[model samples]
Target: MAGPGAYAAVWEPGRQNVTRYRLTPRGWPEGRRLRLAILSDLHVGSLHVPLSRVSELVAATNALAPDLTLLLGDFVASRARIASDPSLADLATELARLQARDGVFAVLGNHDWWHDEPTQQLRQGPTQVGLALERVGIPVLENKAVRLDTAGGPLWLAGLGDQIAFLSRGRRPRGIDDLAGTMAQITDDEAPVIMMAHEPDVFARMPDRVTLTLSGHTHGGQVRFLGWAPIVPSRYGNRYAYGHVREAGRDLVVSGGIGTSQLPIRFGIPPEIVLIELG
Candidate 1:
């Protein structure tokens, strides 16, 4: 059985709890290799959050020496957590410690929506985290895209805001305003386009233009059984549990994520960090 934040279980001394995944996409543009490390569903201040565990996760990500680092949202569990604790500030600092060459980019997760604060106040949430990254010169991307002019010419990294959070504002983007439309702005001639969506469920409507989509909202079922995860609240069934899946011709990799939410317990699934190597 896996807990709400469990990704996978492996046995190793002093590192018995670390989970890692390598994603190699063949047919990618030649000369451009983007090693992206994805950390998702952190749920920083929830009941079962093990700050020490996240620290190790961060250390693991840095050890990979990726070209870019991406934080896939759910930084905190709820609005109350964001507003009440300055300790989250410490967690934000720890996350800021992740290193990347191109830069570290982040998106807002549903947990960041807890207090319903205005953008001014909302800015504080990521700011606390972003400022930490900025000190190291990493930029966070939210519902936006950044073009990386690499040796391969140019590549674009796009990020979409949290779906549940966007819906709560009664201003959810539909049709053209959705992610598919935003992805359209990236020209195909550029290097392959990659998207960072918080939840794997959002990929259903993702445009075919995207070569690979990275997300982490399911926590790999948090509690799973023999390839069957029972607690997946996703619209896509257990298919979203911790691995690679093809949908409508696009590739999606959903990380199991680090930290727990609602409750802290893991049986089969443990926390994990994903390393994706783009060929």
Candidate 2:
């Protein structure tokens, strides 16, 4: 007989849900309404996320017809390399089907950098998944920001490098994320900023200039008991583990994220494709 642990690890993680949240950030344009689709930590080729699941992900996203779609990285499964999974080319091919009015953008996560030895070793340039994303017409934002003209007004989208990229560099796990450099890329001083970071720990120092920040990597702790994540990978513990958070008048939404990491089990928190409406 299969116990609940087995179901949490095997059966439940594969089920996907479309979770929705609404937020009106401090600087969000009054007349502008934006719908965003956030896909995070797919962990393709993981125990539950197979190559075939990409199509399903893309299809579900398109049906929503969001104003913008963001991929929050971790394309490869943990404890494995991109070469071991379905080829990046194959994964990108399906991701290409995603459509958003403002277009789709992406950023690399810890797993993406850790698994791609070439990129991690170099400690610079695009990761294997980043290149694949670009080839399929998705913009990979690496410590970079872009200005988008929206009906509400102009908005700045900034993407940061993974906070923990290399496993070891001089006895410390070095990250490529550049918060200051990324913030400096923004030329629009008035437009509201939305940051995409793979890790949520940055929320503590998140400047008031940014209206909203989106993150993943914790996977809502992959398991929660009565809304408490017993094992959060973040330095802040459960402070930024999951769900929408508002601190000091700024907003941060951490999706439960798809797939599992470190351990392939999910209870109380299932995989989800986040649809956020901002006005």
Candidate 3:
């Protein structure tokens, strides 16, 4: 009776899981392995994802014992029809708890760009969410790339600006992302690259040098049924809507993510944090 309704409305939306994957990408070093914890679409302060939930997920991510943790933006719940949500500062406190051996890095999502009127108006500078994360020691990369020395080898981490950043408002829609610029920042030619992009739609254009691409924006339909999400925010529909995809020797992983977008309801997909073991 009440069980089914509760499962759909509150229980499913409130739960969190760690979805794991192990991949040996084309450019990954032969004997080296990197355990990465990837969190996306946090949409913190949404209906189910409160400060408490964020704290819990941070604890959960740390427990995964990841060598690296990556956040793929949308930390703010700009579109959720909630009465109230936690402040950006409060959300940062919990996110700061996330630990990774190589440190945690992040990229902005469309919602993050859409949420900030000032940034959207100026079409530059860090958003409120970016400042919040950076203050807590989490570096927010927008059209930037950085190199990290790892046991496996030197790994290049590249992150792009939100693709649909200027989708809304009266302004004509366009992406602020500069894939070419971000890729050019990698001075080293041989190191394997791992790119964090908010939308999986960018994977198609990635160069052959990248070892793996990680993304989250669809929220696994945020209301999936039978493993398929009918409504994905991407241009390609369900093609890159979710899960690990291998195309033309490039590896891409799209996280279902932990929070809802437009509506605060999740049915089959639930909420999740993605963990990838890449070598």
What is the TM-score of each predicted model, taking all chains together? 0.79, 0.95, 0.94
* 37-155 per-residue lDDT for model 2 (tens digits): 99999998888899888899999999998989999988888876645679899999899999998889999899888887787667775688889989989999989999998545679
Model 1 CA lDDT for position 266: 54
Worst 10 residues of 2 by lDDT: 76-85
Which candidate model has the greater TM-score, 1 or 3? 3
Best by TM-score: 2
Itemize residue pairs with steric clashes in candidate 2.
none
By lDDT, is 1 or 3 better?
3
Hey, what RMSD does candidate 1 come out at?
A: 4.9
The C-alpha RMSD in Å for every predicted model, in order, reads: 4.9, 1.6, 2.0
lDDT of candidate model 3 versus the reference: 0.86
In model 2, the runs with Cα more than 4 Å from the true position are: 82-84, 169-171
| TM-score, predicted candidate 2 vs. hidden true structure | 0.95
- Against the reference, the lDDT scores of all candidates come to 0.67, 0.89, 0.86
lDDT of 3 by residue, 1-279 (tens): 688777877889888888989999997888998999999998887778778888889999999989889999999885732557788888888899988888899998988888788876887767888999999899998999999997566899899988888755686567889999999899977899999999999998989988899999988777777777889888888888889999999999999999887777788887888888876
